[model samples]
Target chain A: AQSVAQPEDQVNVAEGNPLTVKCTYSVSGNPYLFWYVQYPNRGLQFLLKYITGDNLVKGSYGFEAEFNKSQTSFHLKKPSALVSDSALYFCALIKAAGNKLTFGGGTRVLVKP
Target chain B: DVKVTQSSRYLVKRTGEKVFLECVQDMDHENMFWYRQDPGLGLRLIYFSYDVKMKEKGDIPEGYSVSREKKERFSLILESASTNQTSMYLCASSSHGWSEKLFFGSGTQLSVL
Candidate 1:
């Protein structure tokens, strides 16, 4: 079955510093990877996705993700973290058959000033 | 903007009672999904529907059933609510493309006693 792994349960970053949330996925054939963010008591919002083409994909809120086929990773990154950037991040992958999305265990990012 | 609306934001039910979670999408999306969110575990897909009346079981669909009588509406039903089933339920919708991003509504926090 297609699955995703989020290695870090929590990441503490000082404000204005760079932040990285790690993700890896297991799937047959080329994977359709995605990143999502959820605030407290809210549903998830789409961050970005890696379907094809360039390795680096940029999305809303100045966030970007790098897709590395060799490493089997799609890590979410932000150049400078802010207090508002703190939230729960999730990595997901669509199975090759294209029916559903399998999500990882989630990473919580805490940006403190 | 694409809008997915879940009928309830919070629910409390007794064990052995039937529970219903309703969702509707305004963009007329071809696909709708139901997912449960817990603390450590990310989003676990319970059911998904590709089109009207074409539903498919997801990774964790054992105790849940779905109804998609209209293209814009999708409902998740729990025949016998249990304590273990209490969690945050999220509804999402997207186009038919596998790589398309999903738009989510505010989740329903269901508590079964």
Candidate 2:
């Protein structure tokens, strides 16, 4: 079974400060990881995905995520936070090809201006 | 840009009412998924269709059904809406590949009274 976990229920950061939302995963085989963001009353929007290759993947809205196999983590990050960047973040895992994604419980991010 | 569109942004229905949620994708993607989002519980997949007329149950599929008569469109049906069924329903689509990423619609907030 593939599962994803987001340790934090909420993360608060000041605008212009760096932000990180933690995620972890468990899978039977190699994992395909993804991060998505959801705004108020809106659907989730794709942030980035880690299939293979580099540990660090940059994505939309100046956000990025680092995949650490040893730690079994894929934490979403941003060099500097913006008030507009506040949203709900989710991490997901897929065990193998053609498998459905298993999503984390979600972490709500609040970037204060 | 890939685009997933849901028919309704918000809806209100009484308990025991039959509910229909429609989704369409303009990207010609081969996979479409239905998920419901709730506070704390996150996004739980209900059903997915990899091709026309082909549907698969996801993590949570009870009391819900889906239809995909056309490749670009997918519909989710609640046999009988209950108070617990009220949620933010999201529609998503992705290409037919292992590493493909998902694009999502704005979501439909269904309130069951």
Candidate 3:
């Protein structure tokens, strides 16, 4: 079965500093990776996806994710963090020809102003 | 913009009571999904429907059922509400393709006492 792993439970960063959330995947064949953000009392919003293209995929809210095939990692990154950027981040993936998408445990990002 | 709307924002139910969580999407998505979000468990897929009247069991489908009579709507049913079932329920929709990203509703926080 395909699965995703988010190592960090929470990440704290100062405003304007770079933010990174790590993710790794275990699946057979190629993988379709995605990043989503959920605000307080809100559903998740799609940030970006990596299907088959450039290794680096850019997403909404100035966020970006890098997909590495060899390492089986898709890490989300933001060059400058904002207080409003603090939210729960999730990394999900679907294996090639798979019907279901699997999600990781998630990581909470706290941007302090 | 794609919009997925869940009927309730919060709900409280007693044990053994049947609970219903409704979801509707404005877009004519071919796939709809129901997932439960817990504190550490990011999102666990409960059920999904690929077409009207066609439902599939997800990873955690025990004690849960689904109804998809219309393409635009999908409902998750809890046969008997239990305290362990108390969690945030999220509904999402996506196009037919496997690489497509999902659009999620605001989610319904269901508390089973």
lDDT tens per residue, model 3, A1-113: 88999999999999999999999999988999999999998889999999997999999999999999889999999999999999999999998789999999999999999
Which residue pairs show backbone clashes in model 2? Answer: none
The C-alpha stretches of model 1 lying farther than 4 A from their native spots are none
Tens digits of per-residue lDDT, candidate 3, B49-112, equal 9999999999999999999999999999999999999999999999998789999999999999
How far out, in Å, is residue A50 in model 2? Answer: 0.6
The sequence of per-residue lDDT tens digits that candidate 2 reaches over residues B1-113 is 88899999999999999999999999899999999888887788999999999999999999999999999999999999999998899999999975678899999999999
Instruction: Provide the lowest-lDDT 10-residue window in model 3 chain A.
Output: A93-102
**Which model, 1 or 2, shows the larger DockQ?**
1
Ranked candidates (DockQ, high to low)? 3, 1, 2
- Give the C-alpha miss distance for residue B50 in model 3, angstroms: 0.8
Please write out the lDDT profile of model 1 over residues B1-113, one tens digit for every residue.
99999999999999999999999999989999999999889999999998999999888998899999999999999999999999999999999887899999999999999
Q: Which ten residues in a row have the lowest lDDT in candidate 2 chain B?
A: B94-103
* Candidate 3: Cα lDDT at B86: 94
List of clashing residue pairs for candidate 1: none
Model 2 docking category: medium
